[model samples]
Target: MEKAKVYYTDMHTTFRENLLQKIQRLMKSAGIETIDFDKKYVAIKIHFGEPGNLAYLRPNYAKAVADVIKSLGGRPFLTDCNTLYVGRRKNALDHIDAAYENGYSPFSTGCHVIIADGLKGTDEAYVPVPDGEYVKEAKIGRAIMDADIVISLNHFKGHEATGFGGAIKNLGMGCGSRAGKMEMHNAGKPYVKESKCIGCGSCIRNCAHSAITITDKKASINTDKCLGCGRCVGVCPVDAIKTLNDESNDILNCKMAEYTAAVIRNRPNFHISLVIDVSPYCDCHAENDTPIVPDVGMFASFDPVALDRACADAVNNQPVTPGSRLDISEHIHGDHFCDSHPETNWKTQLSHAEKLGLGTQEYELIKI
Candidate 1:
């Protein structure tokens, strides 16, 4: 495979050009204008930070990207799917509220915000993954699947499960509908939380597979019949249905890669990752700890895998921040992400993505 081109620009800004302008310049220099954006629905996938977590990307960056798309005559919208976990972003209504709360309103980003999944996170499109070993079909949010073009605007950071969240993480796990997320994070089926179940019958009624039943004023899942579609989890009024999250970290990485392939396959896609505020955990958390390293820079590429590899390399090359998580931890592995989250190997995502022919990990970084 040939080395992909990953364009980069440092955080340093001149008096005349601010970060926003720099981002626009970076995108244009990286050939963003080459795409036929004229009159197309472009989904700019991003993580609207969990209300209290301050590590997610700002709306300014999104606006820059949106403005670029608009310049090319495209219709752009900021988007993200509802999260599987209990949080402000669990459902479409709540997810939009969270995005607004985190300063991602249309008024701020120069574009509207759309929760890719419909209300309750059940609206999805089953996309087939031809090269998938773990997932045959990826259940992606309907709104995301409906878009004509896809652009992943990611905040590069460490993850407890995936080692680091980058373009692949943003597109794969981030684009998954509730069921798709369940499939990626769990090796087994979901179970009813007896204590939380109020015998509401919502789960039983929503179960298309007849996998759930109510007994003794409690709900129980028949794992044999359960398909792990996660519909029960979405419909439970009381949040009683829950996934086991039993998938091993490595398998989780591989599943995420397959999900990513399902998203970008046969679609016009681009990727950009900002390696700032390098939090040690995912933005899904309500709180974020100190950054492990100094801000690296911004990166853009047509190749998601190569973009991720470049960003990971940049973060790994930087010096650790004093008093950050990495500074205090025992650095057994030389890699910063590995040292931060010892249980995870971030390379698995890139390697699996490469095997799926998403893109190569080898990249040539072009500094602007």
Candidate 2:
């Protein structure tokens, strides 16, 4: 495969042109307009920051992308699947509320926010992964799968598990339904936390495999009967049930790459990642630490893999911010993501993505 084109723009803005305008220019330069969006449903996939974690991309960037889609005669909506873990975005109602509270309302982004998987994170489309190894069929959120086009508006940052959250991570793990996410993150079934369970019987009712049973007003999952659908993880009103998260980092990255492949396989997709507020952890966490590095900039590409590669390279080339997490860490693995997360090797995701025919890791960076 030839080198993929990844366009980039610095964070330097003057009086006339601000960062927002720069993003618009960057997307156009990256060929976002080339995609025919006439009356099609465009899913602008984004992470509406978990309330209190301010590292997430602002609604302004989403609006810029949505506005461009609208101009091309497309119907666009900002969308994301419910998170598998316990958080404000675990269900559609709370997810929407959190999104609105975080200022991603239709009033802010010029489009509606749809929780991709339905009310309880169970609604999904079983998408077959082409040439998949770890995953055969990916359980993706129904709304995201129903879209005519997928545009990932990603916030690039370091991650604890996958090493970094970029285009691949955004589309793969971010788009999975509750069951799908569990499959990628864990090798074992979920166990109920008795301290948090209120004996609501919500989990027992939602489990189709008859894997859950209640004893003494608490829930217990029968691991033998459990299929690990993760529905019980979402239905617990008090956030009692939890995933085992026993997958190794390499396996986790590979599974995420497969999931990413499942998401964009046969769809028209575009990717953009903003490398600002380079947090050491994901926005899923309620607290965000200081940036590990100074703000890099915005990047866009038709190829998600190349886009991520370019962003990761850009961060690796930059000087670490003083007093940040990167500065505090003593180990230098020659890669910032790996250095920040010593247990993880970020290359696994890109290499696996390349093997899956997603996009080449080699990219021609065009600075605009």
Cα shift from native, residue 66, model 1 (Å): 0.5
Per-residue alpha-carbon lDDT of model 1 for 289-358, expressed as tens digits? 9999999999999999999999999999999999999999987688999999999999999999999999
Error of 2 at 218 (Å): 2.8
lDDT by candidate, in order shown: 0.93, 0.93
Model 2 TM-score is: 0.97
Residue 338 C-alpha lDDT in model 1: 97
Per-candidate TM equals 0.99, 0.97
The collision pairs in model 2 are none
- In terms of TM-score, which candidate is strongest? 1
Instruction: Evaluate model 1: give its TM-score.
Output: 0.99
What is the Cα-based lDDT of residue 97 in candidate 2?
A: 97
lDDT of 2 by residue, 79-117 (tens): 999998878998999999999999999998999999999
Which pairs clash in the backbone of model 1?
none
RMSD of each: 0.8, 1.3
lDDT of 2 at 80: 96
